[model samples]
Target chain A: MLSIRNLKVTVAGKQVLNGLNLDVKAGEVHAIMGPNGSGKSTLAQVLAGRDGYEVTAGTVTYQDRDLLALAPEERAREGVFLAFQYPVEIPGVNNVYLLKAGLNAIRKHRGEAEVDAFEFLTLVREKMQLMQMNESFLNRAVNEGFSGGEKKRNEILQMAILEPTLALLDETDSGLDIDALRVVSNGVNSLRRADRAIVMVTHYQRLLDYIQPDHVHVLTGGRIVMSGDKSLALELEKRGYDWVKEDSAAA
Target chain B: MSLSAINQPAAALDHYRALFASRNVPDDALGKLRRASLERFLAGGFPTQRDEAWKYTSLRRVESRRFAPADAMPIGADESQWIADAGHRLVLVNGRYMPTLSTPAPQPPGVTILTLAQWASHSPTQVADFLARHDHAAPHATPPTANGAFEHLNGAFSDDGVVIDIAPNVQFEQPIYLVHQWCMPASARSAGSHMANPRIIVRAGAHSECSIITHWVGDETAESLTNAWLTFDLGVGARVSHLNLQEEPSRSFHIETTRLQLATNAHFGKHDFALGSALGRSGTLVTLGGPGANVSLNGLFAPTGTQHLDTYVHIDHAAAHTTSQQDFRGIAAGRGRGIFNGKVVVQPGAQKIDARQSNRNLLLSNTAEIDSRPELEIYAHDVKCSHGATTGQLDPVSLFYLRSRGLGESEARALLIRAFAQSMLSTVQVGAVREWLEARVQRRFDLSAGEHS
Candidate 1:
């Protein structure tokens, strides 16, 4: 369902992803584990078509189509979701109103009828409950004065509402409490399907305690240097990334 | 002084001197006021940039042109339906009243509206009080005394106006509408120059209520000048709302001065909307004489095709516990130039006084220009006051946001502009008046934004 060929990415004129290649079929959960300065977040942003990043030498294909040619919102409408590590705060823009706009934009591109306020509210409430988010979150301004945990939870709520086929969970577990992490993990786990794929990015193995991944990749200096089963996460947790760097260089 | 620095009719001042010289003032309180006011006005003539309160706005529009007092009053009752919602109408053509065209409300037991000519002919003392208490007292009250030539002219030409008084604890449902319809006498040899001196005074008693609407219209094709000084007073525990709509003929000039007094626990507000004119400027001062008083000054201006509109509103919290809030917005298109200067002053010991001032402008094209200055002068120790002014084109992000949602680009821009301006509409408590002003804003957006947005 997804393919990447020698993806060379640079952000702010700094190389983040250097010569990385990957492929994943539909029906699989891939966890990308890397220490600091890894290209994990850059991969998520590049996939979502953020404005700044430059794909110096890469070609990304998703569902057999060119994924790099769309705008950020357009990519979102095409079922590519990037759960931001830190969401933006848009003042005077109602949380529900913004979410509704985002949803309708995606829905319209998919050739679906627009939902009315009442219907959208009902759908939002159910999704919020599933993500264990507060009802007031939908009433306040988008991400304005939100707590760290609240921001993380809001990303999950959006993911649930948009229900993207390819979800790039970019550090979704960062800053979340044990309870919030479990809830987020559960929300992600429930979306696993034979026709959907998810690529989770994180720096710690603690998230794997709840949402186990079928495959694990270690990103060092923007390239996937090591690919293994879930045991690689456990090995990294025990031996640290210095051993991974040493081993990758030796290989 | 450079002729280019002046803004209005030169003969307007000359005609004003002639009008007052011709009127007979009885030897009473009103006579004393008339004499004292002329002296003070002569001492402090038309304001200039030297006055910090009017630092950004030039009174040249009032000083340069030559105008003659409408010469002979022209008829205005061709059709009374023009202002149907105008509950109680007071018609004055060229500063002179015609009772046949006026429809005053029942006195409500204690409220009265006496013209300057009538009040001057009778009780001079009652008229003196108004003139004596007219000057707004504050650090900026003197306003550098930068030689107010037109003020002296307005003082000298004050032939007829009105004195409105409301007794304590009285409330009226209908707003007093003062309609000034002017026309340059077709036979008059004024040719390139014509002028009209307009005067109006309003006083509200303690705990009393009063509202007034002033609308200015002239022959759409005539080119003339106008000088006016409208004074208002509010007693303690009283509230007053004043609305001024200046829609001048396509080719005319207007310069007006407004003096306002606010007593302890009194609230005074004025909303000024200047839409069309060859050249127009409104210089006003509102004072808070008593503690715990509030003043709200709201204004909007739209000028097209090289039209010049300038508005200066100043508020003084002379006593403790007084508050002032001001917001003015303007749109200049077709090479029009719009200027707004607003000032808020909080006196010493006026702790807990809250004051805010904001002025914004939207220049639709490169040729169109807008200048705004919002000033705050505070001597009080514990007051909350802030001021800001910004001028720019439309918000591209907001426009794109709306357009992406299926609204056309023009519709998107109009919606955002309307939302930007709706802040002024929220203050009008009268439903009909609020909707009336809103209609003009909507109409303006429809016509102007259609071509550009």
Candidate 2:
């Protein structure tokens, strides 16, 4: 469902993603495990079409569309969702309003009828149950003054409501407590379907325990060095990246 | 300053020389009050930049031009079209009350709406004490009043301003729109620039509620200057919402002073939106006189093409536990320049005072200029006060973000500008007024796609 070939991204002339390649089929969950500064975040950013990152060379194909040509918001409307590591607090913009706007933009792009407020509220409430978010969350400004756990939960809530074909979770577990991680991973697990894919970016093997992935890719120096089942995440956690680096060099 | 040739010579300099000799001022107590105000105006002439409060907006503009204290010529033409948008309006022509054009409303039993000329002509019972209290001359005001040309201008022409008194427990649901449309026909044009000093006094009694929208409108690029002053004395538990919309023509110049005094448990809301004048300068001095008094002042302005707009807001925390929150936002496009200087004075023993002030400005073009200063004068030991000022262009990321969401460039920019102003407009407690304000703000920003939005 997703193919990123030889992708390289640079920020301020410093190469962040170096010849990164990954593929995920529908119904498959791919976990990209890497240490800090190993380019895990950059891959998500480049795929999500965020600004400030220069795509030195890359070709990203999502369902046969040239993903790199789309704007960040266009990419979003085309079923690409990036769960930000730290969501920007848009003051005076209500969360429900942001959600409604995001949803309607995607729907309009797909030739779907725009949901009215009353209907959208009902649909949003149903998704709210999946992430255990309070209905009151809709009233507050978008992530303004929200706690870390609440922010992560809000991200999961968005993923559930958006139901993106290709969702990228960038360090969504970094700030969550163990309990929040379980709830969020459970939400992701329930979202797994035959036609949807998720690329989970994490620094710890802990999140994979909750939402076990069919593929685990070891990322080091901006490239995927090793690929395996969910056991790869555990192995890297036990042995660390030095062994992965050595293994790649030997190969 | 260019002092005009006094037609009446030494006699004109004699305080009431212009009013008495020309017979422009009618009605007794109002006339007396106007004469007394001139005496006070003479005591304080034209303030200069040497004074701390007038530091940013130098009186150089007025000091450079010779101005004459105006003599009212009975304007033969009626200007009912100027108040076309207002629901209930009282027309004050040349500072003289024209009851003929005023819309009748039930006035409070003891409250009055008398022209200063009428007050002087009739010698009303409480008019003397009431008029004397709001004497624009502050004993300790910087540069005093004598050196302030605009104050002196208003003082000298004070014979025609209006006085409104609100009786206890009276509430006027609809906002009274006072349209001060001053015009001297093209035939009356003179060589030296002179001014019409228009004044409005609003006194709200205890538990009374009132709203006044004093709109200053003028000719299409008229060659005149207006030095207007307004003073509001709010009694205990009274609530007064005052909005001064300065929408004068680009050819006109305006210098205005608005003062407010809050009594115990009273609340005051004042908004000043400046969208006019070649060189416009407005100042407000608010005194939080009693405990639990709440005051909020918000101002917005956008100037373009050689226009200079200056605003000075001063809040005095005189009594303990008083509160005030002031925020002013401005956008300057083209060669327009804007200046905002706000200071919150927390006097000693004014403990538990909560004051917040912030002024943010947006410069849309390279030639546009904005100078903002938010000063916090804290003499009180126990108080929470904050002052912040920021000037910058729009955020490129946010701009791009909105554009990517299908907004055309102009629509996207307008949306962001509207959002920047929404926070201020949302604070309007009156529904109809808020709607009007929102529309006016959109117009001020020139958000072209307002209807579609």
Winning candidate number (DockQ) = 2
Q: Which CAPRI quality tier does the interface of model 1 achieve?
A: incorrect
TM-score of every model?
0.71, 0.81
DockQ of each: 0.08, 0.16
Q: How high is the lDDT of residue B169 in model 1?
A: 91
Residue B310, model 1: Cα distance from true site in angstroms: 6.0
For model 2, residues B1-453, the per-residue Cα lDDT tens digits are 234533322333453344434656644655566566566544444565677666666554555554554444445534632545554578865445667777775664655777765765676656666655655554633323322455555655654678777888998767777887656566556645656677788999999988888877766624667788888899999999988788776777788888788899999998888878888888888889999999989988778777889898888888999999988998887778899988788988899999998898887778888998888888979999888889998776665544333333565556567777777777766566567777776776664323222
Candidate 1 local lDDT, A70-111, one digit each (tens):
656666777777777877665445678667766887778879
Please name the candidate that would achieve the greatest lDDT relative to the true structure. 2
Interface RMSD of structure candidate 1 (Å): 5.7
How many clashes in candidate 2? 31
- Chain A: TM-score in each candidate? 0.96, 0.97
